[model samples]
Structure formats: C-alpha cells, structure tokens
Target chain A: MAYSGFRLIREALTGHKGWKPAWRDPEPQAHYDVVVVGGGGHGLATAHYLAKNFGKTRIAVLEKGWIGGGNVGRNTTIIRSNYLLPGNEPFYELSLQLWEGLEQDLNYNAMVSQRGIMNLFHTDAQRDAFRRRGNSMILHGSDAELLDREGVKREAPFLNFDNARFPIKGALMHRRGGTVRHDAVAWGYARSADRYGVDIIQNCEVTGFKIENGKIRGVETSRGTIGAEKVGVAVAGSSGKVMSYAGLRLPIESHVLQAFVSEGLKPMIPGVITFGAGHFYVSQSDKGGLVFGGDIDGYNTYAQRGNLPVVEDVCEGGMAIMPMIGRTRLLRMWGGIMDMSMDGSPIIDRTPIEGLYFNGGWCYGGFKATPASGLTFAHLLATGGPHATAEALRFDRFEKGLMIDEKGAGAQPNLH
Target chain B: MIIPHPLLGPRDAQEFVYLGDASLLDRPDWQHPEAGSAYYEYLYLRDNPAGVHRELWFHEQGDRSWLVVTRDTTTHEILSAELASQVALSKEPVR
Candidate 1:
C-alpha cells in the first residue's frame, strides 16, 4: 500500500489492521529474463530501476541472506560527490541527486540527512589539494566551499583544533553531502521493485554459473538451477569468489573495512567530519551515537571481523582529531568486506563472458554510490552499453592503461 | 596481531604493510610472449586461501625490511616469518 499521512491516521483509527508486508518473500522461479545477484542496496535498487525505468519484467534478485545484511547496513552512511576525478564526479553527483528525491520516489522514509560533510585539512599542501577538489566539485555543478580554521571552528567546535602535530588549517565543505538510514535504502528499493512484479528471492546462494559454449544461460544455486537470459553479479566483497565460479577472476581484492558506533549522547557533531592527517571520519547518528570509521584492515580477507590493532589505530585517529571522543565508550563495531579495485575506483561493465555482467570493486565508496550504481548498472544491463556517466568504469580500463586512479595510490589495492 | 619478526624481536601487525601472497615475488619475464597475460595474472589474480597463507609484509616503521610471513588466515596465527630478500634469493630463479 502507498503510505501517506491520511493512511497512517486511517490505520490508527482502525487499529492498524490494514497494514501489509513491505515486500514479498517470493519463491524463485525456474526462469527469468534477467537475474540480479546480491540483495543489498545496489542489487535492490538495480531491480527497482530495471522494472521502473527500463520496463523489464520477469526479473529476480537472488540474495544469499536477507536484505541489508551486507555493507548496506554496515557502513557509516555518509554520502558525497566531492571528487576531483572527471570519471567519478558526475556518477557520484547523480547518486546525490537521486538521494535527494529518493524518499518521495519510493514513498519511504530514508532519512536522507544532507547536514553537510567537511574534509578537514591540516597542512598548506592539503588545503591546496582540497581547494582543487572543491573547484572540481563546483565545475561539476555540485556545491562546495573552502573554509578556513575560523569557519571550521564555527561548523564544528569540538575538534582538537590546536593539536600540536596536526592542527586544523582549513576544510573543504560539501553542503549536499550527508548521511542516510542505510538499511532503509534497501527496504525502500526492495519494496518498490516488488511492487513492479520483480521477484526477490532471499536465502538463495548462487553456487555456480551455468555456462555452455562460452556463453551464459543461467546459474546453479543452493536451491536449484534457475535459468536466466542475462545475469548481473553485484555481490560486493564476494565478487572475486562468485566470479571465479564462472572461471573469471576479477581485478579486485577483498578486504575487511571496520566501522564503529559509540554510546548515545546529546547532539554534538554538526555534520560529518573527516580527519585531515588520518583516515578517521565520523558523524553523529540520529540516534545520538557517534558513527565513525577509519582505513581497511590491510590484508586480503573475506571475514567480517577485525583485530584489535586496527581498532586501536582507528580510535587513535579519532582521538587525534576530536579528543572528546576519547572519553566515549564504543558501543559496537563491525566489519564489511570491501571489493577494493586496484585503482581505488569501481567497475560497472559487462564481463568477458557473454550474457554475464559485473558490478563491484566499490571499496569504501559502495554505500554512497548505491542509487547511481544501480541506475547506471540497470542502464548497462538493459542497453548492453555503459551509461554516459559510467563510460570510464570498464573492466578493460586497467589493460588499456586508462585506470581511474582517484587516490593516485597506483595499482595497489591495499593502499587504496 | 603480533608478527614475530626475524630480526626484530616482535612487532605489531599494524607497524607492517601487508601485501597478500608471497607468490608476488615470482615475477614472470616481461620479454616473454605471454607477458601481457602474465602481468595481468601477476598483478590481479590471487589465491586468497582461507587457511595457511604465505604473504609479504613490509616493516615500514621498523627495519624497513620486507618479510615473507606464513600465517593462517582463518585463525590469524603466524606460522613463520623470514626476510623476503633471503626468501627471494632462495627461490628457483625466474625464467
């Protein structure tokens, strides 16, 4: 049912008996026109756009676990498009645009809080880099502002502004960037896709791809062998393992990136604040908990848990910037496997195998790029060509020496 | 995780830079006919085993020496560690 204020009052007056499930737990069919793997935000949103925008039916999204069980629910929920690269800026800017109208579009409360995001700069060189990045954002029709130490103090006074080692010199502010309720994005997309007759089959693990004559036909799953004319794999961290089942090794590495939340407190953080000298970035959740994270555990692994040293390191980075966080008790912490591509960017293109497609290598940027990744992926799957905004995100970019090395970290996945 | 360094007594894993799979040391000849595919496989494809794995770790903050570390990925247990230069010299010469 389409949710509305009138509907809420009617339901309240009628004892809420007319409520229904948001999405159906439909059984997997024997065949489908298209199959989208992984039911995280990207997968669900892909299916939603495929049905809504592309007018494709008989689509199914197969998930090994329940929706929002992956990085979708395990991220810091920050979103931004303040990128310096041409290949990245437009795509992420489109995601921010989609996020702006997401709630109204899906008729779901996603809590897209565009409170703003500030990247604190500590040194003169760092300030110049951010100035260039802010200029790039403005060039791409996105909002950005270069703020000095005084401006940063006005925005977030709790930071350790006078830290001897890494004093806050300035910041690059993107007013359109903020956080969203991560899981609600999955729920909203899943519900909308289901409304369009797209089957969402959970607990269906794809064991292998049923390819014959070097072309795709369907997939072999734990449930059964389901046939599909086209298959799209959007499994984030499992990209390497899943694609290997089809005898295709991706240019990706799986690493665990951990995130943390502290005990709830009164609202203190004005917006998301990223440490200049370190990897720490934090924002206050609507629930009053401080949601934060740092770098990925520097190893290749599919595990969803991190060790103590990284935890200590992340806390150190947090304390380096905002010393007040040193007193806060960490409520909970978890890790999500990152599909770290060599160039620190993502790939949204068709794979070498005919009728098979891949959408992964998101690293730390996956959650923020959900809407546009889905929209562009849907465009690719439907049209058999890369979307205009995602033309550079091809698997062959590395071989062609056209790597979109956003971080300029070279070809090292760990460094990215 | 604590990695027992060969030269240094013991060091936290945080102090070292992890580069997965010691097989990266086996660089194929760039003059080979299949060098393109060889470099592709060398740079991208990884074994990513769940059990015992021999990986490379650079002592970035300490001796600055690279170590060949064999550890259990499933349990994070360090089996052994050695100087990567020594391990490279001891390996079968590259073609």
Candidate 2:
C-alpha cells in the first residue's frame, strides 16, 4: 500500500490498522536472472538499483539470517564523504548525495540527518593534514569548513581543551555529515527492491558455487540448487569464506570491531565528533545515549566479540578527548566482524570468474558507503564494467602495485 | 586468550601485537622467474579459513620476540606459540 499523510490521518481517525509488513517473505526460486549473496544493506541496495536503474528483474537476495542482522544493524550509522584521495573522494561524495535524498527515494523514513560532523585536530601537523583533506573534499564538490580552536570550543564546549598532554587545535567540519537510522536503510531498500519484482529470501545460506570450467552457472545452497546468470557477493566479514566457495582467494581478513553506548543523558554532543589524537568518534543518539566506537580489535578473528585490551584502549582515547564521558555509566557493548582488506580500501569489480562480482573490503567504512556501494555494484553487474567513480576499487590494483592506500598503511589489515 | 609462551609461560594475549597469517614468514624470492605472480599471491591472497589458522604475533610489550601462533579463528583459542626465529631456522628455506 502506498503511504501518505492523508492515508495516515484517515487510518488514525478510523481505528488505525492499515500498516503492512515492509517486504514479502517469498520462498527461494529455482532460477533467477541474477542472485545477490547477502541481504545486508549493500546487497539490498544493489538489488534495488539493479531493478530501478538497469530495468533488470528476476533478482533474488539470499540471506543466511534475517535482514539487517549483520553489520547494517550494528554500525554507528554516521555517514560522511570527507575523503582525501582522488580514488575515494568523488565516490564517497556521491554517497553523501544519495543519503541526502534517500528518505524520499525509498518512500521510507530513513532519517538522513545533516546535523554535521567535526574532525578535531590536536597538533600543528594534524591541522595541516586536515586542511589538505578539507581542500580535497571541497575540490570534489563537498562542503568543508576549517574551524579554529575557538570555533571548535564554541560548538563543543565540553571538550578537554585545556588538557596538559593534548590540547585541541582546530577542526574540519562537514555540515552535511551526520547519522541515519541504520535499520531503516535495510528495510527501505528491501521494500523498494521488492516493489521492483526482486525477491528477498531470508534464512537461505549459500553453500557452494556450481561453476563449470570457468563460466558462471548457479549456486548450491542449503535450500536447493538455484540457477543464476550473474552473482554478486557482498558478505562483509564472510567475504573470504563465501568467495572461497568459488575457488577464489581474496586479500582480506576478518577482524572484530566493538561499539559502545552509555546511559541516557540530556543532549550534549551537537553531532558526530572524532578525536584526532586517537581512534575515537562519538555522537548522541535520538534516545540520548552516547554512541561511540574506536579501532578494530588488532587481530584476525571471525568471532563477534572483542577482548578487554581494545575496550580499555578505546575508552582511553575517548576520555582523552572528552573528559566528561568518563562519568557516564557504560550500558552496552557489542562487536561486529569487519572485512579488513590489504590496501585499506574497498574492492568493487568483477572477479576472475566469468560472471561473479565481488564488493567488500570496506574495513570500518561500509556503513557510510552503503548507497554508493549498492549503486556501483549494480552498475557493474548490469553493464559488465566498473562505474566511473568506483573504477579504482578493482582487485588487480594490489597485483599491479596500484593500491589506493588511504591510510598509507601498506598491506596491514589491522592497521588499515 | 592466554598464550603459553616458549620462554615465558602463560602470558596474557594483550601483551602481544597481532601481524596476521604465519605464511608471511615465507617471503617469496624477489628474483625468481615467477616472482610476479609469487609476490602477488604473497601480498594479497590467503587461505583465510574460519577454523584453524596459523598466524604471527609480535610480543611488542613483552620480550619483543615474534612467534608463529596456531589458533582457531572461530573460537580465538591459542593452540601453540613458537618463537618465529626458531621456526624459521627449522623449516626448509623457500627458493
């Protein structure tokens, strides 16, 4: 049913029971034109664009578990395009543009807020680096403003500006960067794709691939054999295992990253604020809990739980930036597996197999890149070529020594 | 996780820094004929299994020694930790 204000008001006046389930629960079909493995945000978005833009149908998204149960629902939900590299800046800028109009496009309230994000700088060298990054963002048609120490203080007065060790110097603010309701994104894209005749099959796990002598065919799953002409895999942390089913090895490792939330308090943070001296970023949720996270647990593990060392390390980083956060009672902590690529960047290109495409290696940035990742992956599946913006995220870049190492941390998954 | 160290016994997992797969110790020969593909596989490809995995961990905060630790990725259980230097000397060097 198409939803509108008039319909909502009419239902409210007359006993109010017109809402429907967001998407259909259809059984797995024997054959589909294209099959997307993984029903997280990126896979659903890919399916949405494939039908909406390329006019392709008979697509099915097979998820091992329920939708939005993976990193999509577990992420910090902050979105921004404040990138600094030629290969990455324009792509993320496009993602920011997509987030700007996402609610209307999906006909769902995804809550794409432009409350802004500020990256704090502590030292002269860090300030110089941020200025260069801000200029690069501005050059790519993104909004960036350089704010001095007084300016940052005016925005966030509770920060530890007079700390003895690390004094706040300046900040780079993006007025368009903010948080979105992460779960709503998954539902919004799934419903829109279902409207375009795409099937979202939940509780269906892909076990193996039926590749015949270097050509595409279908997949062997827990349900049964399903045929597909093209297959795209966007399983975030499971990228290694899923791609290995087709006899392909990826330059990726799985690691655990934890996120935390504190007890509810009155609104304190203006928007997303990241610490420059350490790996800490935080924002206040609508429910008043302080949402924050830091670096990945520095190891390779598929286990979705982290150790005490990282928890201590992240809290130390947070306390160094904002001292007031220490007094808040810690409420909950959870971990999500991250697909840490060798180059610290993502891959969105066709694999060595004829009709198999791969889109992963997002590290800790996948949540922000959902919309653009979906659009570009759909373009690659439909048109057999990388989108102009995503052309640099090819797999062979590592083989050719052309890695787009944004962090300049060469070949280290955990460091990236 | 606790690693039963070769020199020191039962050290906390937090004392070491993780450097990933143990296969990295077998760095490819730079002048070999198949060096191009060898280096590509060496740098990128991996048998990143969901079960048993042999990895490297540097005791940066402890003895500053590197160890090839065998562990399960699924459960994060440490099976063994051997000093990387001794392990390297014992193995047949790759050509």
Best by TM-score: 2
Q: Compared with the true structure, what per-residue lDDT tens digits does model 2 show for residues A1-416?
A: 66679888999998888777879999988999999999999999999999999999899999999999999998999999999999999999999999999988899889888889999988899889999999999999999999999999999999999777878888999999999999999999999999898999999999999899897799899999999999999999899999999988998888889999999999989999998467899999998999999988878888988888888888998998898988898899999988988878999999888999999999989999999999999999999999999999999998888888888763363433
Candidate 2: the clashing residue pairs are none
Give one digit per residue, the lDDT tens place, for model 2 in B1-95.
99989999889988888888899999999999999999889878887889899999999889999999999988999899999999999989798
TM-score of each: 0.95, 0.98
**What are the candidates' individual DockQ scores?**
0.50, 0.83
Cα-lDDT of candidate 2: 0.91
Regions of model 2 farther than 4 Å from truth: A410-416
State which docking tier applies to candidate 2. Answer: high
For candidate 2, what's the RMSD?
1.3
